[model samples]
Target chain A: MKTVYVCSNTVTGIYSAIYDAWKARKGEEECSVALRGAVETELFCEYVEVEETVHKAQAVEALICRHLGREAYWDIYHAVLAADTGKGDAILGAMLAAKTIPDSRRIMEHLSHPKVEKVFELSRSVIGEAHFLKGAVRFRELAGGVLYARISPKAQVLTCLAPHFADRLPLENWMIYDRVHRMFVIHEAKKRWILVQDEFLDPERLPDLTEEEKEYTKLWKGFVHAVSVESRENLKLQRQHLPLRFRPDMVEYM
Target chain B: MSSSESMTTYTYEGIPQYMPQGAGGLRPSMFQKLNILADAAKYDVACTSSGTARSNDGTGMGSCERSGICHSYSADGRCISLLKILFTNECIYDCKYCINRRSNDVIRTSFTPDEVCTLTIEFYRRNYIEGLFLSSGILRSPDYTMELIYAAIYKLRKEYNFQGYIHVKAIPGASKELIQKVGFLADRMSVNLELPTAESLKLLAPHKTRKNILTPMRLVQNRMAENKQELALYRNAPGFVPAGQSTQMIIGATPETDFQIMQVAQSLYQRFELKRVFYSAFIHVNEDSLLPARTDEGPPLLREHRLYQADWLLRYYHFRAEELLSEENPNFNVLFDPKCNWALKHLGQFPVEINRADYKMLLRVPGLGYKSAVRIVKARRVGTLDFSDLKKIGVVLKRAMYFITCNGKMLYPTKLEEDYIARNLLSAGEKLPGEVVNMGYHQLSLFDDVGFSGKMQQYM
Candidate 1:
């Protein structure tokens, strides 16, 4: 006499649905899982469609906190949200699976669901960039009272990376935009963060370095070049560790 | 080799790394000199993590990553965070072993106090590094170099108001007062043995002796202890080397046996309470004929990596150097990791049930890292961890297979053969031909067996 609906996409939407399911756990309300863009129903069933709501989303956050403490909540939430697939089903499974808090290494294992796999990939990509940024990121000062850089990354990593800079440069204002992803994270340090989605802002092109910037850059480049050991020029190993793509953004390379 | 370019010639004679040599004056191009010197000093492997301490307060520069990663790479390829560099490449001491020996016609340079401070701050501010890891070749007398260093660190701290991790190297023969002063400012300090033994020092580096290196090392360790004792009840006490002191020894340069290296490492850890002992695979950077025939016998990297792995065991796993290496078996087994190798030789210690083995016991099993060891301990707190759970705990059972059991079930079913398991773990055989690996454990008799060399055992 009752109905079960089960196809939905988007981890947030999926979590939103499970949150709805928990609310109606004692209800005789018919259920259906539908994809974000799709709706299908059988003849015998009365379809109940649930849209994602912040209030409903809050319950999922609570469930995540309860099921997988604060840190694990983040691990699961981000990993699920990162997946490019049946985010809803993955959430459904992960919520069920998060019953026991796994150790640090096992936490990564839960990230393998097709829906949230992209998050693991994205997070790993960001981590990879942070490491590369360690050796290569170059900054040049602008006369207009700003420091800027041009970096081309292979993933949607700009958002994940803003905090490290913000923590390091608490007094300075800076903008790191993924020109490719078309969104940039701007930090005012001791203030709120802003992510710009404005279409009018052009990001790909930037101004050149000024004289002061050029001077500092030359010193760094000379240091890197001159310090490079003639006895051991393992360019193969150097390039393997630091890819050529990151060179343009690094002060030592520039 | 040319007669003038005698293979045994060190850079500069009469000056020791222990004795710094001059009335240190302000040098303008300190930054360039530091890069030249530190680049040369990079061959010294003592820069471990200066640990995470950020200066990102409402002002200028730096945040440290929790990974404690710094300039150097780990065996599994983890980068160290510290912006490690030397103060000057111009050393007066000519240790035949060193690249910056007065003999090599390499670039000579030194970073001034201001230059050192500025580079550390700039690199840190750009989020390019965590903090400074400054070591220096003694530009002047050890006292003079100490003066320049103290000024540089003082400026970085007081003038610059930098609260970042600062790891400074201690110049031997510098007064204990100087050592005490530098230790209070820096998070960590170091003294390089360069060579392991006193006899070896006499032969290879005439300007230095074991006494010169060990004296300062002991003084620093003593000062660190005295400060730690005095500060026991105080909050944020001015302790010396909060991260503790570390030292480096060039591997393969001296004829000292692996036994000798392990012995010195053991004592350093035991006596000085050192945090680390880095083994630099001697790169044939300078052709010092006093060195062994620059054969394929380059600084054994695999050996260095193994030494580090063993050092980790000694520091963390409660393994003593004597237990790990001794007169009878002075070298680590090249076929298996130190832990697994140990377990193989001491099979009576194996077949430890994962669910019941104590933390110390679990650590002795091959293939179990700190994580797995901790996992084994923590998991047992809940319910018993079976063989399957052991796998989930990330224990590499290949080497550990002979050692641990889960719910009384072996991950692999077999009566363990010592040689079989040892050979099993040495899977990377002949990948590079004509090499006796770092352990000095290789015996041609072990290699002569045709079919027995079918494959090394693989303990997960």
Candidate 2:
């Protein structure tokens, strides 16, 4: 019988499904995996919903750490954080390949392997977006005296970007809200930053910029207007470097 | 006056605005001033922010990372919008090649010290830029311009308390005391060499002599060296141009050969310890009979790209300029890159055993960059690295295959003949920039050379 295992949309939940699937060993072609919110059911397939059990997830984690080493685990973990709907199944397929193929710990480097290639591609996108946002994220001084910045990244990158800002502006009170994910990485002056989830942060309810903020924004807009060389103006190249989606939040573009 | 007096933003029209004082007695809007100055300053190509590691103190609002952050790239695939504007576009000299020459009918304006600091700090706070790249035309004299630059940087550091990277141009004939003062506050300083040769400099820029440019460069170099010694003794001795100095030479404007340019660059690196030598593909702005006529192909961008590639080979690949090109071979081959051309010419260096060659030897091979060379050394230690392992380590086997051997075995029994490898390299041409390829000037490749496709499929 062709069986489809569905699980929650998270790393731990996916790991639990992988654990159950491995224990069954119903052959690679017969068993399939999908995330909870995703429509991935095949016709005539027996569907099984896997509960996210801590023990089951830990069991899969231990198996991966033992066989593929720590680096492979990180590779799988980062790739899972990608916005791809098929990420859960991609990791499951890669894990199964690791079990079957000898010396498959180097699978991430193998572009020929479909599942491995998918994971590698997704990991690069997630990492690349995070790196770009490090330079792109703009901070505005809010009325309450804390610095505030908002980003609507496609990937779930708040966790990836938090540590960098924490180390950078340790003594300042700041908050970087991931508007798409409805999560915030808040850092108090001289204190460690913490991640908070609140889906109710309305776009209309953002605080007004301080007067000092207004002057700086005016200055920045003036500078940006002045800096670009009119003779060699390449709007196409500028679009490639800083995409249009990033324009709405950027003060200069506004 | 206290430094704070010069630190305040230059106020105009009853509000604090950093607009330049007009030499032409014209009060242009801030926007207009920016447009004119930026247009004049655009020819300078050094928009780099690398090689500084300044962290923001608890009080400051910004930090400078050592690796350099490229906040944005321009239309020409160059990094831009680092507030790369001139303090003024007013000039004292009429260099034939310069857009900001006194003889040109362009608007003349100047920025006060306060205006520059305000712009730098504000833009930096918004993360729109990494830092500032300030260059200016000589307003009244070189000393006057250099003093204004010093005051601007001093206010930016002391008054604004901004600890970000700042790269300033040291005016060729600026006073030593003034240049030293600015050097302490600025991260990097550059003196434009203008042209490769003294003859070319005199021919184009009649007013500015070669000696005037080199004198300030040598002073900055010696002071930077002396500062290094003091830094070892005193922890906070204040670094002198902590990011080091660089210079730019205008290509295609003058009649200097690629060999002459490379030799000059090599000497600058060896003698003055310059951080970089920028080669700007000269875009014809002013209509001058003395300058090279604008050809159908526009700028010599391909030639500039080739020189930069050769520069990298000199810096990292341990290849000398003499080995790449001699008097007879003055120009680089347009068909292949410097490394591939070198390898093809000296076929005796072929089939370097990948597992046996040292790091420097591996670097000499085409397609093996510094990162890949290091990875090869690290990976081979654990086990024997076969062709599959080399592919996994991210080596570009297309070029490297002809040069490297796996366990003393060639990937395919490749011949060491120059024509054979050259044909393969041509057939497997990497994607070129549209600007470089669209000119229809490059020699057409013989991709349909018989049996090469069959040979390539055998490896696959």
Candidate 3:
């Protein structure tokens, strides 16, 4: 009978489930990982609930980094952060397939393997969305002078974008709220950034815009309008590059 | 006349004293100046913010990314990477095609150096722009305008500690000293090659000489060479135009052949080592005898797009200008892109074996991008890749299938004839330009006229 390890849908929970499956010495065909809420009941399968912990997650991270190498570890980390519920199984399969390969560090380059390919695809998409959000994330100055931005990215990209913004704006107090994940990346002036989860922001109690913010918004809108060539107006091409989904958060479109 | 009567009445004037008030005297607000200056600067097409990657030293407020970032797109579908605006619209030159020609009656305004700094910092902090793209009209002289640009960028870099990307225009006739000073503060510097040939420059822009423009370009090239050596000797020598220089020419303005324009661009890339060469389709901004006649047809955007396609071929695909175009075939085909057109003409090179072909040959395939070509080489090292693997590797098989062979077998039993492949490729849902799609297939000729297409009038 196949064994299924159930865990919450998160980086830590998935890694802990992987640790439990690995500790039981289960082969690729003998074990599978499933998310807690997205689990499907299977007949002739022994289901086990994983006791998630920070230590288990750290052990799994270190084990992958030590055996699969840093680059493959990076890919697996990004795959875990992806929105796909089957990412835990794909990651575990790739790890198990790595042991059969001549060099475990070259697992990512083994694109012919099904599980490795799935991990590669998921990592690429998560990285792609994070790269786009690095540019598309727009900040608005509130009345208190804190730079606040809101993004609704599919992946858990708050961790990926927080360091970039913190390094880019070191002296400014800034916070980015991921509306989809209900997570916040808060950074104080000249301080390290911290991630806060399970937080809710009331839309009605949003901060008021500063005077300078309104003035700059008007100037930016006018500039965006005037910079476009009158003879070569192509809204279709604009929509192709910047999709309508990202237009609501962008100030120029607003 | 009594002195008291003259002072009180002030009615003894043949021409009244020039009173510069209202629009001329009162300074335009920040909003008005940004609109006027950005509007005047819209004719310039280079808005790229790539080629420089720097991190904030924890002292400055901004950083640069290697691939660059597009904060937004304008209505014309161009990427808004930088806050592209002119320092001033005041000019002493009367170029025929310029909207801000000294003869044209348009509202002119200039921004102070401090205003430029404030706008850059505020916009960058809000993630509204990647950086500042500062160009200017000759306010009084080339050197004078260059000094103003230098002052603004210097203030932005030093006082404001702005470490973001800065692309500045090197005034054509400006002195070498001023250009060098400005280059040290900017990430990229460019001197506009307004026309492709000297004859066209003489016919259109009387004030600008080709020799005057090339002199600054050659100066920047030599200085960058020297800067490279200095940086090699000393690790922190304060780089000069680290992203290198780029230039733009007004396409369709001077009746230059596509072959001639591309040859010039190829030479610039090879000789001057430019980072990019932007081609602006000639928009009818002014109606002068020297310029093209104003018509209902809009800018020759399709022709411009074809030229850019050929430009990419030259840069990335290791293609030469003579290979893409010749004296006989002076322009690109409206039906096919430059690469596909090249491939169709050279059918003997087709059915390239995916497992045995070299990297350069893989790049010549129609649907194989540089990235996909690289993946094929890497993935083929592990195992023999079949058709399905190529599709998973992101190759557009609908187009590449006709050109490539997997394990000595074509994906489909396809004919090697040129006309057959062309017809099949067209039916495979290749997305052509809007104008080309609207016009029926029969209307396109093998060598279509690149300029003044009658089909473009409908776009108006």
Give the higher-DockQ candidate: 2 or 3: 3
DockQ of candidate model 2:
0.32
List model 2 lDDT by residue over B1-460, tens digit each.
Answer: 1112222355433323334544444467666676677767878888888888877666765667687777665555566636788987777788898988878887777677777787777666556777888999986678877877777777888888877789999999888988998999999999999999999999899999999999999999999999999999999899999999999999878766788889999999999999999998877778999997765556666678888999998888898899898887777766567888798888897789998999988998888888889988977776788988787677899889998899999998888888788777767885444543453555333421112233233323
Note the DockQ of each predicted structure: 0.26, 0.32, 0.80
Query: Could you tally the backbone clashes for each prediction?
Result: 49, 1, 0
Winner on lDDT (1 vs 3)? 3
lDDT at residue A141 of model 2 (Cα atoms): 87
Q: Compared with the true structure, what per-residue lDDT tens digits does model 1 show for residues B35-146?
A: 5654675675554554445446666555555445433232223343566677766777888877777878876555656677888776555545567778777655778678
Candidate 2: regions farther than 4 A off: A1-81, A84-125, A139-148, A160-174, A187-192, A207-254, B1-26, B432-436, B439-460
Q: What is residue A42's positional error in candidate 3, in angstroms?
A: 2.1
lDDT of 3 by residue, B343-390 (tens): 988999988999999999999999999999999999888789999999
Q: Judged by DockQ cut-offs, is candidate 2 incorrect, acceptable, medium or high?
A: acceptable
Candidate 3 lDDT, A7-95, residue by residue in tens = 99888999999999999988999999999999999899999999999999999999999999999998998999999989999999999
Deviating ranges (above 4 Å) for candidate 1: A1-59, A66-68, A77-92, A97-140, A149-160, A179-181, A189-192, A197-201, A221-254, B1-35, B70-80, B226-239, B423-460
Q: Can you tell me the DockQ of model 3?
A: 0.80
Looking at model 2, the pairs that clash are B20-B110
